[model samples]
Each structure stands twice: as structure tokens, then as C-alpha cells.
Target: MIMTKELWEGNAAIAEAAICAGVEAFFGYPITPQTEVLEHFSKRLPEEGRVFLQAESEVASINMVYGAACAGARVMTSSSSPGVSLMQEGISYIACSEVPAVVTNIMRGGPGLGNVQPAQGDYFQAVKSAGHGDYHMIALAASSVQEAIDLMVLAFDLADKYRTVVIFIADGAIGQMMEPAEMPPLRPVRPPEERVAWALTGAKGREHNIITSLYLGAENLEQVNLRLQAKLKKIAANEVRWQEYSTEDADFLLVAFGTVGRICQTVVREARAQGMKVGLVRPITLWPFPSARIAELAGRVKGILTVEMNAGQMVEDVRLAVEGACPVRFYGRMGGVIPLPDDILPELDKLDAGVASGREVQS
Candidate 1:
């Protein structure tokens, strides 16, 4: 189907994409950099006979999402950093119950209600089982408005495919930035048959299906944990995605994700123009992080540099990906500050010189 292209903020693009993907319910609270998403949905979704609720709190909103998703409906909710933190308990519950839902975290400065602007401080939280107990969430990072739309659709599919919660992670810059977007026609998503088997949609004619994470017996919980581990292994083997630029003959690889990855794209271009064989590795799925791909490149490259808005959360992941194969270093700024491409150039130069100086340190 033909799609019309128009300029839209990332948050608005996500909301529009969700509607096009047949999302029937949205529950969220107002939070900066992400409020535009709920605002757009509130105005547009009802026109399609869908539900949009501006919940009393982030906690209440996430619970509403949990309820709707449990009923076998496509559900979504969004919030900024602090608000996302408030929704953690519900998210954990969703994870434990193995419910399919979309949670968008338009991140800002962290540790507290730090700022209303963009930041990438929640990298670890997004991928590291934020709620609790041997559960994993599928995490997708969007670098542009188009990506926001594209990945939102992918997020819903993955959530259902895995029968787990999924996160669409973008920073404030992506959330607020306006760019050309194509709104694709809606295609019906077949509701998962398992949802009907397990979901609580009233007694009906069959025996009641209970959705709970609580398993009192240690052996039963151990079996569940084993099953989850196997699932994660399958995801790691098949689901990791990343984008590479100018890696054909590069000595240094610059790694970043989300909006920071977009910024690094420009840096990679400039560095190549100045006769530097520098490349970039941008992770698309942060949870099933493209570790094998990164590890494969580590054998061919001289060093890896991780750039982010936060101090060094994602850097740790890069280090793990490389696994002492090469030097991994970090350069970042925190608390709503963004690192400009120009500012990054000097660090690139220093890394180049450090590699040349024959004192390469393994990250």
C-alpha cells in the first residue's frame, strides 16, 4: 500500500504508527518529551473508536495497560524517565505474567526527576530486567521519526511473538525532533491463540485460565526459570539487529544507540572525510544486543569507542560485546547535555593516537 510522507515529531509518529498497527487501548500520564505521544493519541485514537486514557499516575496507567493486554487487546503506554521508574512495578508484573504490551520510555535525565530534556541514562534499566526475577523485555531503540514508526510496529509483533513485554526506547531529541515520515496502511495482526488459552476474558464455556507469576514451589519456579533462559538464548541467537557504516576497512569503531547513534553517524561521516578509517556500529535492538556482530568486528578493528548521553551505561555493554578482544573506551556527557559531533572529533583523534602509541587498553 502507498504511504503519504509528512513531517512529524518522533512521539507523534509513534502514536500514529500504533494507531495504524491496530492498537485499541492506550493508558499513560503526562511527562515531558513524551507527553506529545499521549496528546496525539488522545485526539486521534477516539476518532477510530479506540480508548485513550490520561491516567491519574504512571503506576495506574501501567496497571491499566496490564489489564487491557491481559484481555487479549493491543495495548500501549508511554512516559519519561521518572515516570517510567514509577511504572516499574507494573512492568515487572507484566513481565512475570508473560503479557504482551508496548511500553515507550522517552528518556530524560535520570537517578531522580533530573530534567525534562533528552538523555540516555536508562540504558541498563531497559535491558537489565528492570522489574525483577529472570524476566527480559525486548528493547528497540529509534534514531528518527521514521524509525519510531517502523520500530513501534516491530515492537508489537515481537511482544506478541515472545509473549513478553516490549520497550520502544527513544530519547527526548528523537521524541521532539520533526522529520519526514510515511504512515503505512494498517494490516490486521492476528491475535495470538495462546492469549485466548491463558487470558482472563470471563469464564465462558471453558475452565478459568489464571495469569500469575507466583509459583510457590521451588521446583516449579526452577522449571519456569529454565524455560525463560532457553527463550532468551533463542532470542540472542536469532533476534539481534545492528547497523554498520564504513566498516569495510576501519581501525576504530564508534558504538552508540538511540539518538546518540544518529549523532555518531555524522561523526563517522566527518571522520571518513578527514581520511580517518573510522566506522560506526548502531544497535537497533538493545536487549538482544547485537553482541555477536560486535564481537566479530572486534577481531578486525583496532579499538572501539562508546559514546552516549549518560556517563557510561552502554559502554559496559560494548565492553562485554568486545570481550577483551580490543580496547574499548568511553566518552559521554550527562544530565540532559548532548555531545556535539564537533566535540567528539577530538576524542576520536585521541583514540587514534592512543592506538598508534602502542599502549592499547582492553575495555
Candidate 2:
């Protein structure tokens, strides 16, 4: 029986969003705190005449997604930290093949098999090097269940539009939390037969479409890489997204994304109540990373502080954005630890101290 509850856990909401967005096939293995994504799909997709495969491992799951994607199906896969690590090779193949697929990481803490709690430690993996390639995915980060639903829909369209991978990075907290969300209006899945122009259907009346990542010749491979880089540059120029909160007049800025960005938003409001001139810059799209906006903010603010769930991954990008125009400081809580608003304010406060000293804050 379908649970018609008004409140939805984040994973469940995402699954429903996928169905509404016309996701035709899902290939994934269950991992926590994200198994709910699989659970929801296993029960709901078949009801809508869609396909769901519980693969043997994250490796098998992603390759399966790659195959289905090559067939021009709207496909998806998801996992937590360790599982996501195992799928990197398959991700590389999908990138080079230029297939459209959506991979969501409901992040948990990790070095290997860390823990089943919320953390934003996958920023580097998702943004810096999604796979072993000089390619980029349309990386989107969601703060609330509604945004998660909305982004999942956008993720599919963007993947199909660009013929590239799109990643949705949500932390374990967002994966497991209950929130009221309205599903997007339904859209019908396009028939695979209609995609014969690109899909690998048996050649009957047209040119055989070959979908492989192999390029043995040096010059041919270099040209392919160059075109992919062109696509990435265009995506970066067109898709960089962020929100400026109380930033028009601020002395220090808190730079964050994903879940930390949500917390920092409250820190902005509360800090303003206390008469502190601090603001927040939350990156909405993590890969095309809104760096230009961060750079502009650096010129406007006295200093910037990066808050993360790891020692400091995204801080490197934030520093790159600022380019030493202002000091950038990092404060992190690792291994499944979620930072509170209070935990972040002190870090933003420290940026001023470093600015006052004129000595760069050492990481």
C-alpha cells in the first residue's frame, strides 16, 4: 500500500521526485543512511511501470546505470560514502561516454566505512574529482527537502540536456529528516524507441551508434578531451548558482554549501540580531561552484570563513575564489558531526581577528 503521508523523509521525497520527473530506470545497491531511497523506489517504481534493479554492489549498480543511460533511459543511482567511492570508476566511464545519468550521494562520514550519520565530507569527491577524468558533472547541492525534490528534477533535465552526469549531494541528516514536501507535477517518460538517434538499438535502418569510452589514437582522444573541457567551461559559465544572504553590507562572510549552508543562514539572521555585520554565501550548485560570486564577495567583505563537515575540503575552493584578497579561515567537525549555528558563528568571528592582524589565517 502506498503511504499517503503529508510528511516525507528526504530520501523518500527524492524517490518520488524521480518518479514524477519521468525517471524510467534505477540501478543501485542499498546503503545507509540512504537505503530509504532504494526502498522507496523498489516499492513505487514498478507501480508506475518503471524498472528498478538492486544490483550486487555499488560498482555493478553504476555500470548498470551507465548501460541503461546509453540506451537513453532516464536512470539514477545513489549511495553513501564508501559505496560512492566504489562507484568512481563507473562514473569515469559514464563521463567519457557522455551518457546522461543522475547519481545522488546521501553523505555519511568516512575514510573507509565511516558511520551512518550526516556529514558534508564528499565536497571534494563530488566537485574536485568526481572520477578519473578531466570532465565535470553538473553538481547540485540541496538544503531542504523541497529543494532536493526540485533539484532531482533539474538534475535529470540537465543530464539529458548536456549528455553528462549530474550529481545530487545531500548529507545523511537531509536524507533521514522528515519534512513536508509537495511532489512536482508528473511528466511522462519519453519512449526509448524515440531516442534511436543516440541510443544503442540494433541497427535496422540507420547508422549504428557506438557508445564506448575507448579512444586508442592519441590525437582522437585529445580532441575528445578538449570538447569535454569546452562543455565544462560552458556549464561553469552558465550554471554557477549561489544565494547572497545579508551580504550587501557585511564585514565578514561565511562560505558554505549543502547542509552547512542552511545552518549558516540562521547564523546570519541571529548575528544580525546581535548587531554583527556578517552574511552568508551558500553555493547552490557545487561543481560549477559559484566561485565567481565568492571572488566578488571577497572584494566586498573584510574576510571569509569556510565551515565544513570535514577537516577542510571546500575551503581550498573558497580560498581559490578569494585569491588572497581577504583572509580565508576554515573550521570543521569531522566523522559524522553536524555543525550547529552556534558552532559556526565563532568561526566567522575569527575571520575578523585574522583581518585585524593582517596575518593570513593558517588553514
Q: What's the residue-level lDDT of 271 in candidate 1?
A: 93
Clashing pairs in 2: none
lDDT of 2 by residue, 1-363 (tens): 343436889999999999999999998898999999999999999999999989999999999999998888899999888898999999999999999999999999888788888888888889876578787778899988988998999999899888999999999989999998878878988887787368887788887899999999999999999989999998888888888898999988998888888989899898888788998998889899888888898898888888988989989999888888777888899998888988887776666666778665634
Whole-model lDDT, model 1: 0.88
TM-score of 1: 0.96
- Extract clashing residue pairs from model 1: none
Shift of residue 337 alpha carbon in model 1, Å: 1.3
Model 2 weakest lDDT span, ten residues long: 1-10
Q: Estimate each model's TM-score.
A: 0.96, 0.96
